[model samples]
Target chain A: MSKDAFSNHPITPEELPQVNSQSFTPLSNTYIKVNLMCRLVFWLMVVSALLIIYWQPWITLHKLLELYLPQVQLAAGGFGLLSSVYGILADKNKGYAIREHDFSYRSGVIFQSVVSQPILRIQHVELKHGPIDRHFGLASLEIFSAGGAMHTFAIPGLPEEKAREIRSYVLTHSDIAAND
Target chain B: MTSYQNQWLKLSPVAIVYFAVQFIKTIGNNLFYLLPAIFVGYNQFSENALIIISGLGALLVFVAISALLKFYFYQYRLSEGRVQIHSGVFQKTHIDLPFERIQNVRFEQPIFYRPTNHVCMLLDTAGSNKLEAKIIALPKNIAESLKQEILAYKTENTHEANDQEPQTNEEQLLNSRSMRDLVIHGLASNRIWIVLGALAPFFNSLSEKFVKGIESFGVDVDALMASSQYAFWQYVLFFFSIAFVVIALMALISILGSVITFYDFKLTRSDDRYIRRNGLFTRHEVVMKLSRLQMIALQQNWLDRALQRVNLKFEQLNANLERQSAGTSGGKIIVPSVTLEEAHNLATETWPNNQLSSINYNPVSKRLAIRNTLIAFWLFVPLAAVLTYFEKTELATASIAAFILSTAFIILSWKRRGYAIDDNFIYLRKGLIGVSYRCFPIHKVQQTTFSQSWFMRRFQLCSVKFVLASGGQTLPFINARIGEELIDSCLYQVEALKKSWM
Candidate 1:
């Protein structure tokens, strides 16, 4: 333990050590398009499922649909539009930076946060591509460390090739013995 | 060695009975929904003994056949430092578990298996996958020998000879809890609420039974109720007696549960591993390597503080998953009801050179007290108003009493919130009702976040959360400068440490 580092009182924020987020490059804007496509597919599936249930002969809900259909439609449309806009805006704030010793990710619009993980501490890296992502030729890279579930973070909307390259690079560079 | 030569081997014959019992239990659980139908049919067909007998016989035969088939198909082989299992009727599955990846191997011998000299062996693996390979009803000698072999292989591969202390030569008795200590632990554990919660579903029936029993005792309950003045006293006496009985029962249950779970508790250190052995009926032995330890928590409730005792709990990797699946209460190694001094000693022993007593704790902002009190007041005032509206003066009085108690509780909790960080470790102490002192190695912190809301910004306060392999620890309403400093230092340490976390 370093005794000299101990202080009776807290230092001012100006005097505190800083981790500069400005050094990290912003994420590619293509992620917003990918997110929109995925959301569209999700909403389409949800609407179709509702329509199928409504059209079913066994369901007597059709009688009440006349009273609620317009309201439900309006609500669904509004939600879809709001989510799309939020997705585009949120994408602008999402960014990740890879450094020699560690990687840092900056996220959130309302309550911004920056999280950094040392490269040696990374347990594993996963490349995930959903149906929509595959169609858009985009992939999300998930990085997991030996800590809590919350320690894991994902960077979405990377080109599939870029995602694969990053995954391979992380796997090769991270401390292999630490994972065991 | 001869057993190892065998390509594949079946479990002991005793496994047939084990499989049959397991099959029956599974069927019973899955067929719970059909219980009503079965009961109704049995009532209607009571006169037809032949039909019932035939049906039961068919089911018995089916169970026997399936158990036999399962036993026949299940085979395990040990080869090339790996244990391989093959099973399944239609879709055959093969699982290969390497000895190097095995985190822990456990052996259990139930009373039924005693005569047969068979034991169940379970191999646990680390990571989120939580894979457990079980070999049911193997010969006790074979299981023991296999466990030794696997452990020997793991030790040899995981640690170098120069870096590792010889196991048997360095074995030391760390601590043991006595029966008296366990009793205090049970009383002070705060598990009475859990016991009461479990019994909540039967509260109505139990109360009804009590009233009926009282009625049978020839008490004029209706006459008592008819007189308003006398009824008040009688009701108070009745409720007091009920509360007394419930508390007594809960105390007895908690004490018994603690005694049973922690009987003859012992923690021993050998080489770089800590071995815990305890339990009354079913003795359990859990071994964890020091390298795999994620956090150590020292806990003391209000009652424990009065008793001058604290519990030291060591959490290893995947401890949460183990607790969830095994349903083992207090799954971590808990040196139950040790004196505060002894708890500190144990913690220092586990993490050498880190004197817990010397670290200075920095308290959170005092403004937390006002915030919490206001929140509690807002939450309770409306309920009190509603009770007053309903003209339940007695209940309203009780609610106000509760309100005052909760306010005091919040203030006490606020007073207890503080955190300290040294070069090697960070210590966080916080909780309500019970105070917990959590210490995590600074280098092991996977992630750190410092966030400040607009309101917090005005006060120069922020909440810092540190993510460890085991879980996350948060220090709320702390000086923003301190939070930022801790985060930066933790990140620096994470990058600097050359040693592996696991």
Candidate 2:
């Protein structure tokens, strides 16, 4: 076997490029508004359903509703409000960094995580946007690796053009087999 | 290409039995959904034996015809170092697997094929976890030659062909398990618990039936218990004896299963490939290439630890996230009941620089124990309090006991969780009652993740996870600085080594 010259040499930690040294670029603020709007629509629909159920007479659930309907509504409203607040805080903390040979995404409000995927290992990259996201000019970039159905991580709420640029950059830098 | 290369090949006539078996397995797998229907129609069918008999006969006939049709439609061809298969009666599907993409070529000899001297060949590919192609009921000679042809093709197409010449292909016996060793491994492994778990839902009914059977034999168990013939201490002794007998019986069953599954187990190495051969009724042979191996896991449960033995598993690029049948998992070869020294020796033999025994493992932060205990208290204390308020003293006591046991387990596991790293390899040790030591080359990591909860961030501690082709391994609650340093070093090694993780 042909031995490489640097095979036996160990690279010290000081010589490596530290991930924490780089600053992360925050996501688009419009995603927070979109998330709030989605949450509002969902709670409104839930309230309407509850009202319809209460007005209906065919179902015998009226007896149970008469005792617990108010409490259930209050709980639902409280949960909705709490989740929206958490979502906004989480969105504010979400950020990503485009390193030379890898991409890093940092997220979570209470449980913070910084995930880095090597460009050489990425199988493919996808850009997706829901109706609400499109209306607010935002897109999400989904990165996939081999051996699993779920994406490695999806960096959400990027400007549409920035998402496209990142996708193309990943495609160009990664191996050709990634396109397949 | 060989002379048979471009011509369509049909399976032997005996493959009809194989297809019938496959059909039955498929039906059995989906039978859960049909259970309610069967119950609903039970009375109607039970009153008329003729209808039931006719229905079963028709079903058998249908199964026979479908198996025959499936065997007739299945055809495969070999051309230009690739295999193409055409199968399915109604769907008419096609599969193409190139020689290079094939990961392992395995052979199985079912009991039914013994009389005919035929073996079943399964081709495992890297593109998917499922078998790429299966040619059932092939003559032994033909299967051997086919395997040789594929291996030769793979060797020729490999990038490092010059170094991997035929002259260096010398087979060496690495390890073999005797009958005693196999029995010990069976006893030590946790498969007994798995078996009991599968039968747990029926335990109450099973015990009731046992009591009734004794009563039918004219043994008045309840009357004897009510009589003063047995003292309290004697009753306790009787209970202990029965428990011992049950445990012994279960252990015996587990041993029989282990012996049948891993009888005459042998591991052999030839150049860069490791071959494992085992099993009793259905002899199995699996081949693993060294280049594709991702990690090695040395697992020692409580019993295995007491016996000073460990079960070593060589993991590969297994896209199968779920457990599968023994032979077809494709990406792992398990060496059961090896000594601690032997396990380390084998690991070093594979990776050369993996000094597993000499490495110092740095334990994770103690804050892990506190956090886990807090989470457990948050989950269990409220339930225990409610039970106490409802005057369910027994249940409340049980809840508190469970909480204590879980808290102790968390603390013990936190003390054991550690990571050791060197220039070439990274090792992780973890478990509560048992321990699993996993190690891999630093360059094999495909991704690195650093996570910290609000509580952990307050203490400047974080968790780091290394994602590999096999799976992900996490080192929870470590210093934030060390986590960053580890990630930076791993990323550097991955980028600098320029090695293919596949």
Candidate 3:
């Protein structure tokens, strides 16, 4: 296989293109809230577990150390900070790669992975948003592939109009197959 | 007992009673494990016992909490066009499954559940490959009532089977689609599958007993060898004798199982639908639209081919849906045990008016069959050797070798003998045990590709692959030109088909 097969978009479009304005309906904010709420719950679990394990409840003199936390607490804080730094650094390097045949994307820190789906394999497309995303006109694009109900591709932080245009690109195109 | 009325007035008090009995049995089984712990924890006899008692207490507490949470949180309702189920003790799942998405619904009420009128429902959903989501338990009456509600929504009042006739045009649309063949097909299946099933447990028990019996004779090999010497060829003879018996028993068990399960196997064709219903203990009904079939397959092992029996399988276009929650409909293969002529007739039925296969078949070259035979012989040599070694007997080894050689010879012969296709269907006869002939409408193909390995490429041979909506099935290794022509014809046919088959 050629290296080009694996490479992200080597060519950058100069000056960001305007969003496609036709047939766009932003996703309901409820979807976004539900997704974010799930993410928040996961975060809370990790946070609470760390607090219970590391916090010395009986040590009043260690209150100064409370600012620093016990051993496990420090490790968790270190982890959070490490992830935040990596997230922003990775986000800076991240750029959308679009192709006539397929698309590629990567995100997250330790769990970072790249996903690519052929247009022919996509079964459906959906634009999703939450209340916070609605205010910013930001939406997430999800493309279903094959028989799977979940998204094959999820492009986050895109304007609602862009998501709709992507949906049309998938829908109106003959090369792509649609779910019945 | 609270009275519940069925819209269909078809109530099997048996379904609900079976479910209740099973539920009670499960509670009883759990109690056997839980009673001692409960007594110890409640009595709190000693200091050392307190820890163990507390552990048991904790388990019981957790169970109670989970059950409480479940009762409080779980809710399911059937609406006009969909069934909405919301369930979670802590993390909730709101499932909105439309009635149209339901593919197959299985009602299972275990033997133990015979006392109470309760039945568990397993719904196969389209595109979602998960085990069935549970619909709430209701009286047999209510269950039947719910089924009628959905039927009423989907069917028009015209061809009413159940009491609630369709009032709207949408239900009429569903009614127009016939289902009379479904019941008919279920009745024709073979009864041999049940007989086979009954023998399975018997063989398993026999094997276990034999193992124990052998162990009871003691572990020292010297004594066994000495005793064996008094007998004929000793270890070799004894081992082969036992191995042969075991293999025969296992094979018999499997054959019987297949016979019993498919004892009443039936397939009925009505208009554009092929309905197959077969099962013994648990009957199954599957209805497939003719147009949705991706391929009609005919297979015959050496034994079947020689006997002039062919097993026909029609593969439908579907997904690897999760076992429980699958589209009510999926790609299915109808397996009918029939004579070779019947299979040919069924293949024609697969494509009612089709004449020739899309690809022209050139007989497999003599060299090709020789090549295939050599590959088979090579693969089987090591396997035969290993089995002999495991059996540790000369007679067994000889018998196995003879079987292997004969199988390879059959493969060698079958490959040389092939058929040609003209324009619409593909007929393939390959392997000794894996004989297969596949037929599909050339026009229904969505995409086609020809692939070649280096050796094949050098030989001007390539494999043509046709990808339909279901999945890709390939006819490998043919002339590159022929492969290309077949691909082009398929593509052209697909293009000419203006209907939205997507």
lDDT of 1: 0.77
- Model 2 chain B, TM? 0.91
lDDT of 1 by residue, A1-180 (tens): 223455455545455346653465666767787677778777777666766765668857756785786577667767887887887787887887777667777776656677777778777788888887787788988888777565787777788998898887777774543444
Across residues B22-109, which tens digit of lDDT does each residue of candidate 3 receive?
4556778989998868666765556568677797688666665555555556666655566777776679887877776665444443
Candidate 3 off by > 4 Å? A1-170, A173-180, B1-75, B88-91, B103-121, B131-241, B269-272, B306-308, B321-333, B354-361, B364-423, B500-502
TM-score of every candidate's chain A: 0.72, 0.84, 0.53
Task: Calculate DockQ per candidate and list them.
Answer: 0.38, 0.58, 0.03
Q: Which ranges of candidate 1 are over 4 A from the true structure?
A: A1-17, A33-88, A148-150, A174-180, B1-6, B27-69, B88-93, B114-118, B128-130, B139-142, B158-171, B212-235, B319-322, B325-331, B367-407
Query: How far is B398's C-alpha from truth in model 3 (Å)?
Result: 14
Highest TM-score, which number?
2
Interface RMSD of 3: 12.9
Q: What is candidate 2's lDDT per residue for B42-161, written digit by digit as tens?
A: 898789989789988998999999999999999989898888889999998788888877778888887778789888998887646554687777888888778777877766765464
Number of the candidate with higher lDDT, 1 or 2:
2
After best superposition, candidate 3 residue B326: deviation in angstroms?
Answer: 16
Docking class of 1: acceptable
**Fnat for model 1?**
0.53
Write model 1 residue lDDT over B1-502, tens digit each, in one string.
4456449988888888878888998999989989868777986778888888999899999999988988999999998899899877677878889988887776655557777778788787767444568888788787767876787786677666456554463559999889899989889987998878888998898878877887999986677678776657678897899899979888888889999877888889877778787777555667777888878998888899889899888876644554542214223666789998888888899898675756878899987887788888888788889999999988888888888998998888998898988768898888887788888888887777666666677888878888877787888898877777788778766775555577
Residue pairs of candidate 2 with colliding backbone atoms = none
Give the TM-score ranking, best first. Answer: 2, 1, 3
